[model samples]
Target: MTLEFDLFWSFRSPYSYLATPRLAALQEEYDVKINVRPVYPIAVRIKGFFKQVNPLWPPYLLKDTVRIAEMEGLPYAWPSPDPIVMDIKSGEVPEEQPYISRLTRLGVAAAEKGKGMPFLYEVSRIIFGGVKGWNEGTHLQEAAARAGLDLAELDALIEKDPDHYEKTIAENEAAQKAGGHWGVPLMVFEGEPFFGQDRISHLIWRMEQKGLKKRS
Candidate 1:
């Protein structure tokens, strides 16, 4: 019996970017399929999640992740311009309704085409792959191409049909019903839920315990 894991992820998370390449390689190592499900980040999904994060979260997370990158032997650089959706103005960051909305919609669109992982990989490269920077006038088009994707076509699809995109997000929420979690980067395997990039190893261990057969 083949096993499949649903990996719910968000593009804005640094950890998500770090986990992408490794997750992509797992297909070659295990007899299982990873269904990448891109979702809105907590800041977008929850009204005030970011504000509630620990005061030291930003610096601490940055320091800790750099250590992880060194241990994993991966290039680590703070994303240029950052992938966050909020904007600071008048000494107060605005709600960032539009940006977050667009990201969530686009994520759903990619998932609908069964190209979630591909899209995530391409997009994350622009944000975290030590590229110049990812922004409105950035080289996103070129980056997408490098990742074997087409930016123009993806934009058209999302622009032309938004309802379908909304539905995909809804479907993901429903699928997580059994797991009792609504967080991104949530990996659900055999009804067990492991959330966050840090949980990937645990997820693989669980898969192994469930009789994950190694390839011959």
Candidate 2:
């Protein structure tokens, strides 16, 4: 028998990017299925979320992400055109978001194609792995290819009915909240929510308790 879990993730989240390689490894090594559920970053999900946060949070987050990347020996850099476009000075998110909406839609399309995890791992590397101009030229197309997907096809699906993809992301956000956390890189197994990239080992412990087996 295979255990299944939901992975609530976001393109703009450093933690989500950090979690990808390990998550992909887990899927390959264990008899488990991870349902990749991509959601918009909190900057877009909750208006003024950044503004309401303590001033210390952003700096601490930056410091922490860099250290975490070093600790894990993973290359790390913030996205070039941040998936969420916001005025960091004012903590104001723009109404016309040109990046996150498209990325989230593509993620949903990939999930529909049963390649969500690979897509997430490949695409996020471009965005967060020190690549400059990640949104330009064929960066995304190449990433999709690396994941064994077609970016053009995924884009066409979103172009056909963008609202559908948006709706799917909305549902993912609501589900994440219902799962007990609004953070990305969240893993929920049998209704137990484990938030943050650091919680992965704990998630596996729970899986072991549930008789998780290796793939034959």
Candidate 3:
């Protein structure tokens, strides 16, 4: 029998980027299915989220993500033209966000096609793995291809029915909250929410308890 879980993720999250490879590995090594649920980052979901948080959080996050990447041996860098357009110093997010909306919509589209995890892993790596102008030209196109998807097709699907994609993302966000957390890289199994990249091992332990089997 195959076990399945929902992966609540975000493009703007460095931890989500870090978590992708391991999540991919889990599916490769075990008979488990991961349903990718893409949601807008907290900065977008909760207005003034950054402004209300501790001032020390951002720098610590940067230091931690860098160290984590080095420890994991995954290529890492802060995204250029960040998915969410916000002033880092003031924590002011613009109402007109050009990047995150499109990216989240595309992620929903990928999920619909059952290729969400691969698409996100490939695309996030491009954005967070030091690619300059990651959104320009063939960058996304090539990434989609690597994930066994056609970027143009995804774009056309979104173009044809953008509201549906947005609604799907909204539902994902609501489900994430209903599952008990608002953070990215959350894995929900059997209605239990495991929040954080560090909690993956615990998730697997629980899976093992439930008789998770290796792929033969």
Q: Model 1 Cα displacement at 131 (Å)?
A: 2.3
Per-residue lDDT of candidate 3, residues 1-216 (tens digit):
899999999999999999999999999999999999999999999999989998888899999999999999999999987998999789899989889998999999999999999998999999999998999989999999999999999999999999899899999999999999999999999999999989999999999999999999
TM-score of each: 0.83, 0.98, 0.98
Model 3 — which ten-residue stretch has the worst lDDT? 80-89
lDDT, candidate 2, 1-216, per-residue tens = 899999999999999999999999999999999999999888888899988999988899999999999998998998897888889888999899888888989999999999999999999999999999999999999999999999999999999998899899989988998999888889999999999999999999999999998887
Considering lDDT, which of the candidate structures 1 and 3 is the better prediction for this target? 3
TM-score of 2: 0.98
**Whole-model lDDT per candidate:** 0.71, 0.93, 0.94
Per-candidate clashes come to 1, 0, 0
How much lDDT does candidate 3 score? 0.94
- TM-score: which is higher, 1 or 3? 3
Instruction: Report the number of the highest-lDDT candidate.
Output: 3
Task: Give the Å shift of residue 160 in candidate 1.
Answer: 1.0
Sorted on lDDT, best first, the list reads 3, 2, 1
Task: Kindly list the per-residue Cα lDDT of model 1 for residues 1-216, writing each as its tens digit.
Answer: 668898877777778877877777676577877786666666656666666667677789889878877887777777776556464222223565555456566666666666666667777766666765465674767655655566677778888987777678767767865665876668898789988778888988898888887666
